[model samples]
Target: MGVSDLLSLIGLFLAIIAFLDSSERKFILNKFSNRDFFLVSLYLILVNYLIFYQWWTNQIEFLNYFEFEGFPNTNTWAYFISIILIFWFLYKIMYAYFPNENKDKVLQFYKYLIAKKEYQSLFSYIEKYDFKKLRSKKVDSFQVILLEEIIGNKLFLKETASYNFFFIIELLNTNDNKVLENNFIYSQLTDQNSYTLMNIESPNQSFFKLLFHNDEFFLKSIDHNLRHNMSDLILLNKYILKFYLFTSQKKIVENTEVIENVFLKIIELKKIHILNKYFSNFSKTIVFDNNNSDSFASLFDLIVNQLNQSLIVFENNEELKFSFNIILDFSLNHYEKPYLKTKVIQSLTTKIDSENFIEFRKSLYECWRKSKKENESFNNNIIEKISNY
Candidate 1:
């Protein structure tokens, strides 16, 4: 190979290296705005053209080292091939720098921030803009990458007050449902130990609150986690109960199925305290009008059966006795009719066998008697009925 040919090869190799580097470190190219990208692309094109023109005019041999015995016009073919590759690289650079959609632009900017490790700036950017507008597959992909970075660095383990950890929480709080819906990101964030850490570190349960409130889809996801024993049952139940409490007040009709399904899962898990809290708040929301009365009755029956089974299973447990008393107490005191309370007591008495019924009555009676002593307004009639049973 002549020196000119060797120089040409070196130039092509440099161009290929530049393209590969730009491809791998896209954040660099993405840093340019559309105008800047166009200018840079034009400059690169001019430089490439100048080099090609010099080679063509000076009769610079193309790949002189290779013997092109069969093909008489190898030089022309090589020149065209090189031109095609150079333009292809330029096209890719353009695409990276000037994404088609706003979401893609946001995603590219986020990639730039992450690549530069400009977390503080990224946090500010996240706080400044509403990410709901950028909900897309690219955003979801970015979120997964961001979450992986947070997890890999054990950033969540940091004190919640720290900016780094706060940034993570903020990112999670602001992103769209697609981010949380990603199975990998969901599992990482909701992993038993990681979730426990987040719960402890977060103030006022903000992490869980934002997480559950942002999307009803998570209710089903959480249910699946609970069923598979992939999450902390008690912690999740607490959050779900809070979610329902807030959602019920809004009367979002769409959330009815979501609420019921999550509640049923909690019942299946037999979280007595959570169940008591949910039912106490839930009963107040029911209108009991003609439209929903039958549904309420059916749900009430299901709850009664589950509670009855729980009472049997935890017959000797004091906590269960207190939960039962609370449920009954709330049902009686809060509602004028108190028929739901009556139905619950009747279910417990009739569902259990003779021996178990006696023990349940005795436990409930003692709990009510204790509660009566603590509060003067406790009903004596219920106590008398239980004692007689």
Candidate 2:
């Protein structure tokens, strides 16, 4: 190939680029992938075609022409480097002479903080900012609200400021919604003391919201109410209880039956009705600690026995039977322990007060304890519990 062939090849390459740029089809096709594989396949096809073109023939041909001496010169290392330096300098000069001076670099640090849900770091750091100071900078734009992140066709101020470098900000929407809208707000610079209130309008109930700090400069004290339809609140209650029951980091308080009974009622009236689905609920959270391997399992054992006696989910549904069996199997395999034997006895004493169900649990514990004191593992204890029962 000579200078002429190279020019023709470069022209073809440029035409492909132009066609791809003008059409989304090329992106979907991904024709640029695996060029080496395509080349090898082409070579094999050409060889096969040659055999078909003329059955018996022997031929060899080689051609070469070059005017320049030492085409593969060692000096090319220094020359190519100098060429790169020259091009970089030219690009810098061009950037400096532009209308807005140099283009600002994008800050990438915000991506990690938001995506990882590193709530403590994100919220704590945002609390410290005084938005009034950041407003002074000659920034280009304030992205206080990304309209897409919240409810569709609605607005939310999810992210506002740059994490690494500052930029100018401008507010585009002043009176976007006339009705209730405020969810929260934020400050990017402040490290403490950040919250905002949004009214949660309901038929009889009310709620206030709070936001962390942010510094994108559209600093306004304007707050809005969050109105909820009946269905919305009902759905929300389910999620809130699930989150509360599973995520509450507080120590497991040793509540009396009075406390536990009240808690169950609250869960039934406020929490259970709101649940969209209970298919994924398990006795233990994914971490398998079940709050703790001790007091909590004792709690679960009591709860499951109570569930067996309840009208909550009538035991006849085959699907529910499977779910209950899973709960029992996991509890027996993971939670049975000798240490909780006396604890179970004490709990049974209180629980039996007058009900025969209490004696049932007491009997179950007797079987559970004998297996445990005999140094049975979880499986053997489960086997022993079944045999004794």
Candidate 3:
């Protein structure tokens, strides 16, 4: 290749680099914006064009004066067309690098914004910074303005953020790798006091601690939000049981509505994991002093009511049926108090038909009869209550 030809190739290479950098496809440099790429590419392309033009002008003059040997002069139309085609090829290759699905999605989001004419101010502010220096811990003044603009826009509603926060919480409990820890998306979700602006109830740095560090705080936050929080109550059942296992008077605030709703969530979800955790850990630990005993009584009352209300589902939901059976067996075996024992009997006897629950009923009555033999003074009234059922 001639000197001008080689220079043209260099320009094409720089243009490819610029495109890759701009589109965030370059390794490491992908985090940086396109400002430097654009500036450097413009300078190199301008200088290259000038030099090529100078060489072309000389070649043209030489051709007019006398014919030269070897390949056609760089001034020829064919040479210029070849250079343009190479640049076009480089630009077109960007689409292939992007992968069609992602490229189409980006294009669609762009097209949607174009149609709405929204985010013009945000885009202008974004253009001002190279983004390499932008930190999740602290955003610049312009970035803050952009954030405020997005917050105020009708397109981004508080409800949307609230739902998303709930999603992150659920994923934190179940998903792998402990995602959302020190992540960019997590930073965006909670940073720059954005949580407040998003109307997400999660208090700034506190949310980070809740997700990765403390189970108690996570439970209390769920208790705090209660039924008002997640759009899907069924999705919350496992967490409620987890909270019930971990929570104490110090951890959870007293709210009858919240407690009832939590029970209702459990009934709706009917998940075996929740039932297993409750039988394995909850009954053994939570009941302590008179205060906790009363609380436990109230909770058992609610469970009875919820179970009665969903008897049809209980008969069909094997997990729910098995959970009640375990609760009955545990209460009979471990419960020394006549009051808690009677409550357990009353709750279990609610399923009088026993067509589907016969095994559970038989096991429970056998345990009660066995208990009566151990102590004749053991509340004859409790056995009367069981016989009445």
Candidate 4:
């Protein structure tokens, strides 16, 4: 290419490079990044025109280098070589500025690990995943963690696990709040055991998506209905995390309970209050087992038992108080025999005192009012049965 053509091409190429970064995730836009394409293309045409202009005017300067004597000071072939080198440097610049190009390769590696069921490889996959640098980069800030893959937003994971996870993604924006938007019950909207993709906007303006994928494990595969009724396992896992953390620091427990954000915090400060709550809620129990055919209820009962037993073993609170009976109802209404085998009516029986139970039932009804897509209610006889408790 001629000199004017070359400069025009270079300028255009730089402009193209600048154009691609306009997107939020600038890593893989249109799958191309060669800036010189447009620059060099336009330069070739313009440079040829410049050459013609030089010939028409009989300008010797246009045909010769002002810095050199003729076509180029160096060998004619060197001109072409320099063009190639320029392109190479341009490519280097593109890659250096936008480094997430290798993310596809990383994802391929992730696929391989997933295929092998290599759970431990997750740690390395996250660490090795190439990230495009932006304003702030920190271990706590950016992550391609499994949670994101399963549930787009709506949750964040602690570098370490904890029980209060359930309360993490609270709805601050009333407009999008599930309660106001008629997006209440989790089971009603989502398939009983599918990945839920949510984009969670954080108060800090930075957000991460989480993907919640439930496998056909013991509890989920229990029965067709039970699987659907299965409790929000991810939320429960968070609860487990908080419970363990509190129990571990029981000696300083009184000071540990402090919750300023009701939606975001599980148990608040006033250690005595939390301790009293937990003491009055769960029973001293340990019950999960490793079994292939175990249903959701069976496996969950085991986990609850183990969790309760562990809590009680630590003597952090009262053994039997709150109704894991709620969990039992969760398992029964969503899973069980006929539902898994064929179509059948499914109902769950949770034993609770009728007085406070009525209030709980009312709240449950209110939550499901928008969804559930069913108008049926417990028969009067059924209410009498529940009242017997």
Which structure among the candidates has the greatest TM-score? 1
Please give, for residues 229-272, the per-residue lDDT of candidate 4 as tens digits. Answer: 34333233333323323233331122211211221122322233
Q: Please give each candidate's TM-score.
A: 0.42, 0.28, 0.39, 0.25
State the displacement of the C-alpha of residue 184, model 1, in Å, after optimal TM-score superposition. Answer: 9.8
Please give the RMSD to the true structure for each candidate, in Å.
13.3, 20.4, 13.1, 18.2
- Model 3, span 1-389: residue lDDT tens: 34567566678767767775333332223222355457546654654554466565576775344445675554464456556655654554332222323433433443344345644422422333322222334544443333333322333323233333443343333322232322313333323233432443223443443543444334444554453443223334433433443445433335345445565565567665664554444344335422454556555545544544544545535455544555555555535675566555555555655455444444445556654445343335343434544
> Which regions of candidate 2 are displaced past 4 Å?
1-280, 290-302, 309-319, 335-389
lDDT of 2 by residue, 1-389 (tens): 23343346448646765675322232222222354336545643543433332232222222123124766432343344434544643453233221221111111222234555543343333222212322333333222222112111111133332221121121112213212123222231121122211111121111111111111111222111111122233222332223323433232233223223333443355343222122123243322434354545445544455544432433233334443444444445444555443443344334444444543444444444544534345435343443343
State the TM-score for model 1.
0.42
Please, what is the whole-model Cα lDDT of each candidate in the order they appear?
Answer: 0.49, 0.32, 0.44, 0.33
- Give the range where candidate 2 is weakest over 10 consecutive residues by summed lDDT: 203-212
Best-fitting candidate, scored by lDDT = 1
Candidate closer to the true structure by lDDT (higher is better), 1 or 4: 1
Model 1 per-residue lDDT tens digits across residues 84-186: 7557556654433334334466565665755666555555544444333233335555445544443223323222123333434555455544443343234
